[model samples]
Target chain A: MTVLATPQPTISASETGTETVPLLEVENLSTEFATHAGTLRAVDGVSMSMTAGEVLGIVGESGSGKSVTALSILGLIRAPGRVSGGSIRFQNHGELLTKSASEMRKIRGDMISMIFQEPMTSLNPVFRVGWQIAEALRLHRNMSKAEATERAAELLERVGIASPRKRVSEFPHQLSGGMRQRVMIAMAMACAPKLLLADEPTTALDVTVQAQILDLMVQLKEEDGAAVMLITHDLGVIAEMAQKVAVMYAGVVMEEADVGELFDEPLHPYTQGLLNSIPRGHSRGSALKAIPGIVPNLLHLPTGCRFRDRCPAAHAPCGKAEPPLQRMPDSARKVRCWLHHPEPPK
Target chain B: MRNYLLKRLAQTIPVLFGISVLVFSMLHLAPGDPADLLLGPDATPEAVAELRSDMGLDRPLVVQYGAWAGRILQGDFGRSVVLNRAVLPEILKRFKNTAILTAGALVFAVIFGIGIGILAAVFHQTAFDSTAMLVALAGLSMPTFFTGIAGILIFAMGMQVLPSSGMYPARGGDFFDLLRHLVMPAITLGAVSAAILARMTRSAMLEVIQQDFIRTARAKGVSERGVVWVHALRNAAITIVTVLGMQIGYLLGGSVITEAVFSWPGLGQMMVRAIQARDYPTVQGGVLLIAMSFVFINLAVDLIYAWIDPRIRYS
Candidate 1:
């Protein structure tokens, strides 16, 4: 493990206070679920930021709170689950967490939109594809129904659906899984949002279709100059698309760095384990070096480091207290491991 | 869609036939002969026997059913022995009254039921939700007669706000007067069905709100109202409409109690009087009409199902 041997300055120091604002800045975001057993601090004090047209991938195992963090950014958390603490600043809108519902409504789908995992269930089954897409247009842009319908048809064509006019009138069930996902993308991009929170957008699609969706997303992001917060468990997806990467485990950021550096020289033990576990054809004969224990249950997490039990490099400090995410001295990376203890906050 | 409707209509033939046979057999199997009821107690056994043959009640069960079935096919429902009137015309007159009462009650049921149901679901886990659901539960279990009588006692007798019983035609064909008397019966009959519809709507809304599209809707900045009302409710409506159709069917049969309690002069009350006097033709004709109406209502509901969901139409 390089462990940020040569520390470098992160992007935020110079980026903030500049004339242009970074597309998104999520600070100290803490999400919790009020379950029957107990309160689960799902996303515990996570902080990640992105710039316009940038792709920031949040990669984690199942139940690691990556999706929860994305939902927090959108203020989309439902009852029994909530963003207990956070300030999500998007473009110029200050502290989205504190925005009134009506204000939030104005920002949602217009300035910030979302694409979900299951395309099959993500589109309303009853409505025509044209009407569904037109809905976003009408809500945010106040476009007349006729204009929105015509624009929806154009969007369908843009998403590569054949015979856009005909497909626009068809129901969601009439489309294939890939086509449904394309429709979802069209709806998400209808308003040309500045930031798109896509929680596993291609996870439910076939291998062949996943590439097409990823490519379409990249093209759309480039065209609109929109930032993307891509939440996925698939590291390959992150490597293929993201510029920066944040590795989350047990509701906290274990490590974050430029995508290339994070993949090549992982600083955190958890990040190393995650990267090593990916199946490779060259290593076919050897058994996969799977991560040691399963994720800790959020409701009854261990007293010290949440991943301590599962961590291979766990030691005395790991048992005593959980490590706060410490920024490296000269590196543009952050890790919440005890070995890289930076100056404590005064 | 047309083919599907034609197929559905064809299927109803068997169902209607079965209901007719059941209605006919049930009346015949019951004790108390119609001839005996028509003739006085002072009449001799021979006189009763003469009346039985005159009324064609002396024939075998199969022969009697065939003759009655043939007449019914020819649009002759025979006549009411006790009422001394043609069965078809008397039932039709009362049918109009019942139709009005049912239509009035349905308007009340659908409006309040769906509205309150959506409110309860959107405000789920709140005091309004709990209380509304509780009232809905009561509505579901409480019989129509109980509510009908209670409405009369409270609104008519105690408050003197609305008339207690009967239609308005006797009081100078006053349309508003009919409405005044209609208030209690409509509410009483509609309450249970409303509760049923409300409960179905609440659960359906609750389920729909949890779907992935609802979250997608919120993420896209659709207002919370639009999310719940537009996106979630449209999906929930699929289930809600199915139950509403069933409620309409069940309410038709249940209207009997409500009509009798208020003496609204509808088919249900007439049927009650007919059953009491052992009027076989009126009872049989009324039952057949109700059974057929129920089937047709369900058919209408199925079409509505297709209309609400594009998925259902193709299947």
Candidate 2:
């Protein structure tokens, strides 16, 4: 797909201050699960960085290791699954991957928080939504019960819930899906963390409510000045909200670029296929081009380039070895494709 | 809540009525005559006839049931033919003993049952989990009577640490002595039910701990202890409460065997003695009271559900 690069305003930390560091730097992270089938690599050598208040969207199909990366950052991977290799460096907190579980607990809802996908099943059914939000405040802020409860109601009002007082006393099952998602957002933003991990937060909501939740998240990020790692399979969400986009397939990122550049001139064939598959205004009456083949099983991934089996540009060299994630000349964009990095071995 | 209680109480009338009819009819259908038992083996035929008429045993089954029901409505359970005492007072005394035993057994069952269950669930797939579950399986397989006898042999006969039978010393022992006598029988009766409860609690906890809300709690920075106990256990309590209610009912009814083995002077032993002696009044009275308590215990359990989870509205 040949397309023009769209120029968009950059929101890099370097532009703000010469000495400012990125809020989160995840370097060469790998997460694996030991299964009876074998050791399955859910996330393999994934690397990315985000600055404060910036939005980085990781778009991929199901089972593409997006969620695992998010969980690894929080040190939440339970038994059988573990972070085998990684360095997660937070701005204020040193390498998080080395922190003890208790230390991680202190950072989790304080400096970095996460909002999960299914709002319906995410809230404790036995508790009032207000109490749930207040619990985080009480735990991290050491607020009095009365103070936390009042703040919880105010947060509910802030998130656009009506009759916040009455709603505060109601159980989670009493709320609709959209309202529950709003409650989740309110809770995550309670302590105003430096980074927020929203894992398909709007995936379970209705279409109309999806936009509202996204709008609320954008507003919260703006207010809190928190960097967001928004993981989703929806390209539309990436185009609308993310400043940077990372296209992941088979547990590896194929392309990472500014959102405008990625959408305008997607470098990888998989990224191009994703863009083409979206039914645009001009392609209304035509058939959409779908990427051939399904995502490879992580247990038995293809030997060389993971995407070679599904790439139309695949040739002899593509099967020889995996391509490194190389930066484009004079640009911040990065791509992992032999087409862009074709050079004879030394 | 008041309305709910009133409605639940109203619903029990038909149940008690149904239980009374079944107990009364079954006692009558059994082969044996209260008049013969009261008169003894050497009594003349004319004496037996006189006594049967005097006691209203010569009347039709319907007439006898109607007379019994009318007296029961007046808060009178009639007199026991063999014991020669008021059935209500006799039942009340025996019921107190049974209640004490049942409460002790329930406490034993719940504490150990829920404790072992949570441990097994938290340490799932470990040796402790496996061993605890194996013990539970063994407990479930053994009958209460068999357990009671084995308990007597081990603690009473072998170790000589407790009495083999009875609620207390005949010479008015202290509370500690009574407790010593109660320990063996209570554990014997509670073991099987505790096993059932432990299995229920384990499964319920496993299910609750896997729910997405638990992950949410942990994500909220709640401690692991808080996640399991406050978040998961409360959700699991709904099922645990249900099993507890059913097991309590079973314990009350099944205490008969344990009481007989221990000679604890509870309603179970009284019922057995009454049935053998053809004292129809006492037997009917004991069964009816047990059934009523079972119904009330269930009602309390339903109320507890609302307490544990506010989302459950009884209305």
Candidate 3:
């Protein structure tokens, strides 16, 4: 893997003796979906925290419940899917899980916002791009139509769209995919939200456009100083953008560490497998190390560690019981494997 | 836009010509002669022959069609053989009455259909949605004429609340009174169309509600009402509008049966009377007018589609 050493501050103000709190704190979050077979536990007791101005990258394969965790935080899960248990507390906003629907409405788009994958489908096709952005301003900022429209054009320009005044009147279908994503970014940044949840924002774009979008996100993050939770399966994105990383597998966090520490000495077997699977320049001709087996079905997950089926280092004790996420001694890293447990099984 | 409209208008000529030819031939092939029907059975054969010859029925079919077509081109619909009045004036008089009933029924259909449809969609799979769908299904299965008869039996006979037949009561009341007389027939005529509109609206709303744009709207902190009505409903409108257009054409064409059941003095009833009397010119005129109205309504619908969807532009 090509590791880009991007400088990011890992410590928040609270750690520097200030009384500032973490930007977001999630505890024991569980989400379920009702199916004909039974209740499928899609997200099983996952928890993480982020501080102001931090970029926390969550890396996981498909069906690992990364997106569900994001949706659960935003309270966007709909019928057949639900957040069964959890306490999500923001710095200024109280427990989000306990907030009324209307209270959540006020917080969303104003205090926190989201940018989704597939910009082509994320925007309302019938509406003008400028109008869409202006809608957020009008709703949250209480700006007049003219003022909101003017600000929308300014936002479009800020997101590097050329001739934003002209682009404002155009509908989404008339714009290119890259332009649409820029428009989405402009909309998400409309109210200067304190936190932004980006779910694979560049997965659908071309590589060149993806680079540009990432650069734009970095620039916006610096300018606004808003905390972001970036969710993706691409390890390269985590190396380039994240200060903290969380490795998730089958709805459980397999490892959580500072990005540098996690890359240098990945403690969990699943995290080690993930890092080794990445092809390096020196090993171009050699067979890449691929993780064995797929993610277990959430409805019938094994009784022990969820990754035991695919772990190359599994032994007799691996299947005996589930492993708890425990902090390592003399390190700010956590791993959910028996090998890292204080007393390893004999 | 102008060019497209002109082209659409030009296309109607062929349609109207085909209709005229079809109506003329069908009336000619039917086993009835206008002169014989007009004349008494006791009349002599010489008298019947003189009457047919005077009325130009003795001419060849092609010649008679040519004469009728030429007069139509000059804005003359010939004269009604049985009524002994100009065909154009009599048809216009009846068309006005049918237009009133049709318009009333259409208004009722749109308001109730769209309302019920939005309600059902917002409620989705809830009990309200199921019950609304069931009522719509019932409406779809029952024919308008059957509903008209049933309406008359209940409203007119049992409750004695409404006048069962005619455009106005025998006492000849005012406009509101005419509207009162119009209620049962309009509801009967509008029921099936309303059901169709509701179902279309519900399906369209369901499809639109699942779109990513709806999710985006909800994420923007827009209320559920705004998400459902403003964001989802507008996207779903193209299908609903198309269905409404089709229903409008059906209403205009199908109102004849409703008109007949209620004894309303509309072109439908007049056409039925003309067909029974073997009045070829009057029948031809009425059918032509109805066909033209249908074509025009479809044209209006096309224009409406352009208005509702920004992607659809007339060049």
Candidate 4:
């Protein structure tokens, strides 16, 4: 309710691709884990806005906290890790952070649902796959058992699994890895939420299956008219599916831009290095350009820019302090770099 | 499921044969003359030899074993040397007494052990968890005989609310009286197994609650209670049952010390008395029955495990 008035969507020549009405607005979100050694700030001051029906991909390396940010939006962080400060406004539901646990439960798997990375371990093994799919319907929609079972079968068919009725009663272990992921998708879409949060949805699948899952997710999203917040480390996936992409590093979003803009002219050095690291057929003779240095430990992050130690263009100013995310001059893109913001934190 | 059950049952035959042979040989091989124990040390050699020959103890070792094994295969456990009564009937009567105590203990252990374990795992690292675990540790270390004696003093002697020993009061007693006598013995006997079950259940549940499926359950908007009781507990059940099944094997062997302390007329007490007098038939019969029950209980546990996990059944 305390949201700043969203400016009117101006039909511009540059095609920023964010002119649609906003569906999710996350403002200065911070999530921290209290470990034995110290507090680990996994996701800090992350802000992003996604319009309805848009697929916004958040891309980062393993420990860059992209997964944590998605978990924060869904109120899914468990013990030791908590959403320390944030405001997540989803559609007309108001501030998600202020909602009680029960209230949040009502929203989850209803207006917003999530699909995790490992489908093999994601579904309860003892329960039938259909029962798992039907569970969300029973929880949020209060569908009767028979009704939910019918819906579950239809969902399986919709996800391109043949002979849904027979597959419905089968256990997760009986299914292939690709089939299990499809079942997970069916479970997520059981209630047909306005938003879907998929964290590395295809990272654990075969190469061909990965492409199929990606295509199926996009196709289902289009058919259902639900926006997707895809968290992944694959730039190719983002290029193929997302309209806007956010590149994250060490718990902060380093750059946010249109997917095409990111792949064509990455504003941040980290993004530039990530794109260059992709080993292509034509560049087989030359060695790949991998980003230097390792991800800093979250508990003991340096005093300045997180990417500074590894950034090829690091200078004296980059060591002093971190830079804020600011809008680029010509388009609806943002970057957090000393080159982009010479004044630094101030 | 049928195939698995049948397979488990068939596999018990060789195991039963081995157990029977061990039981028969162990009692017979022990250094003791049944006739000497029967007659006093003052008995004449003529009388001792006459008694040994009369009892067929003078027969060759292989012949005696063959006769014993043949009679046992015909469902005859022979007669107790001391009591001069049928060993099968005597053991059966004693087994009934032991079953009552074991059944009561099973109820107590399941209710308190699993309940506290689940609660402890759910509230792990909290004061309740620490306190419950500490109590379980004490329960495990404390012997049943000591607990049974203390329980007798506290509840039977001092309070005068319960019978001190036996399946019932000396005079004819009702079912209520039987229960009154059973309370102390059951608690004392079950204490150790309950502690073991609690530890197993806690660790199993802790492991299951950390699985991705548990997170999936949470994401589905399942209540916290449902997430734990339904999802986590179901996954933990196989491990918990394996421990419980092993405990049943020990339980059937009878809580010997607890029964003795309470003066309960169970097979453990009978076996102890029979052994004191070298009553070979009674000792062999009681032990063989217990070993057979242990095998059957293990089979039952395997069936339960197969039921809980489909992978085991289908594979």
| Runs off by more than 4 Å, candidate 4 | A1-21, A342-346, B33-67
TM-score of each candidate structure, all chains considered together: 0.92, 0.94, 0.91, 0.94
| Per-residue lDDT over A1-346 for candidate 2, one digit per residue giving the tens place of the 0 to 100 score | 1122113335444655522787899999999999999999999999999888899999998999999999999888987899999799998788999998899999988889999999999999998898999999998999999999999999999999999999998889889999999999999988989899999999999999999999999988887778899999999999999999998988899999999999989999999998988889988999999998999988877777899899998877788888899899989999998888857122
DockQ of each: 0.75, 0.76, 0.72, 0.67
Every candidate's lDDT: 0.88, 0.89, 0.88, 0.89
Per-residue accuracy of model 2 over B219-299 as CA lDDT, tens digit each: 889999998889999999999999999989988998999998999999999998887877888888888889879888988
Candidate 1 residues A21-76, lDDT tens each? Answer: 67788999999999989898999999988887789999999999999998888788
Candidate 4 lDDT tens digits, B1-315: 799888888999999989978987876678767788789899999999999998778998778778888999998998998899999999999999998999888878888899899999999999999999999999999988888889899998899988888887788799998998899899999988899998889999999999998888888788899898988998899998999998877776757887899998998999999988888889999999888888888888898898888778877
lDDT of 3: 0.88
Higher-DockQ candidate among 2 and 4?
2
Q: Per-residue CA lDDT of candidate 3, range A1-346, in tens?
A: 1122124356545565323688889898999999999999888899899888899999999999898998888889998998999889988787999899999999888888899998999999778899999999999999999999999999999999999999998889888999999999999999988889999999999999999999999999878878899999988989999999999999989899999999999999999999999988988899989999999998888878888888998977788888899998988788999988977666
Q: Candidate 1: deviation at residue B315, Å?
A: 0.9
